[model samples]
Target: MSVYLFFEKKLPFREKKRKVVRWIQYVIEKEGKKSKRINIITTGDREIIKLNKKFLGRSYRTDVISFPMNGGIEIEGEIYISLDTVTENAIQWGVTTREEWRRVVIHGILHLIGYLDNNRDEQRIMKEKEDYYLERFPE
Candidate 1:
């Protein structure tokens, strides 16, 4: 299992490589999925918006997007996170930027793990899963 972290906008995120990878592994294994390759890229709004338009046909900014690239059992995907949106969401939700960032990261991973939030019920369940994973994450 490998979780690769990359940066484009150089956001002020307090994450270490080892710890973040372990946290990702914990979530994946607990969800009954094995990750062979996972890429987490942190960028700004413009880049994510471009991806949203190109791949998803949405011309708006989003916090994160997950693209599953696996054909077998192992999970392989790319998660693009927009730090600008994450920051704004943190302020809007009255949480620290780091906290919101963590939530978004897990949210993307859950998406790659077959979770959805297209409706109210799915959003609630997804939020509950995020809360469960975040509460159990080792700080």
Candidate 2:
């Protein structure tokens, strides 16, 4: 399995890129998959806002955005993240930068696994899954 990380800013300090890759691997393994390919693109707030509007039809900024390749056996997709949002939320949530970053990473992966957040019930379920993964893979 290959989990590639593409960053617009300097690489994260707290959680190495490889750690996130391993976390993805763990998720795939837990899902009974032998291998899968996932790519992550991290950018600034401006880029994320552009993507949010273009793809999601929302003008506001977002922390993480995911594009799934195909809903099939082998998982493949792209995860776009905003480091700016992560940093801001980290401060707002009283967590470290890496913690918030990891949370977003897990949130994106959960989306790839068919987690939806179009409504309040789905959003709560997705957040629960994110929180569970956060505890599963902690700093």
Candidate 3:
């Protein structure tokens, strides 16, 4: 299993890279799935908005957007995140940027693992899983 993270904007912090990769690996293992490749791209709000409109037909900005490439035994996907949105959300939610960033990354991974937040129940369950994993993530 391999995970790669790319930055399309200024990097947020220097210390969280290893932790983020470890967290992703943990999430995949916890879900009983193996990852062939997982790519995470961190960009700005404008880029994410463009992606949202082009791929999802939504004309608004979002914290994260995921694309699952394969549906077989191994999990393969791309997770796109907007650092601008994440920072804003972190401030709004009274959490550190790193914490909110981790949450968004986990949310994208959950999506690749077949978790959806399209309904209230699914949203609740997804949030539960996020919190569960967040609690165990290393600081």
Which pairs of residues have clashing backbones in candidate 3? none
Q: Please write out the lDDT profile of model 2 over residues 1-139, one tens digit for every residue.
A: 8889888876467456677788778876775553367888989899999999999899999899998886666777889999999999999999988888888988888777667899999999878877877887734
Among the numbered candidates, top lDDT falls to 3
lDDT of 3 by residue, 1-139 (tens): 9999998976576647787799899989989999999999999999999999999999999999999998766899999999999999999999988889889999999999889999999999999999999998887
Quality of model 2 by C-alpha lDDT = 0.82
Which has the higher lDDT value, candidate number 2 or candidate number 3? 3
| Model 2 TM-score (2 dp) | 0.88
Backbone clashes counted, model 2: 0
In candidate 1, list every pair of residues with a backbone clash.
none
| Candidates' C-alpha lDDT | 0.91, 0.82, 0.92
Better of 1 and 2 by TM-score: 1
* Model 2 spans with C-alpha error above 4 angstroms: 33-35
Model 2: how far is 3 from its true place, Å? 0.7
> How far does residue 120 in candidate 3 sit from its true spot (Å)?
0.5
For candidate 2, the per-residue lDDT at 25 reads 82
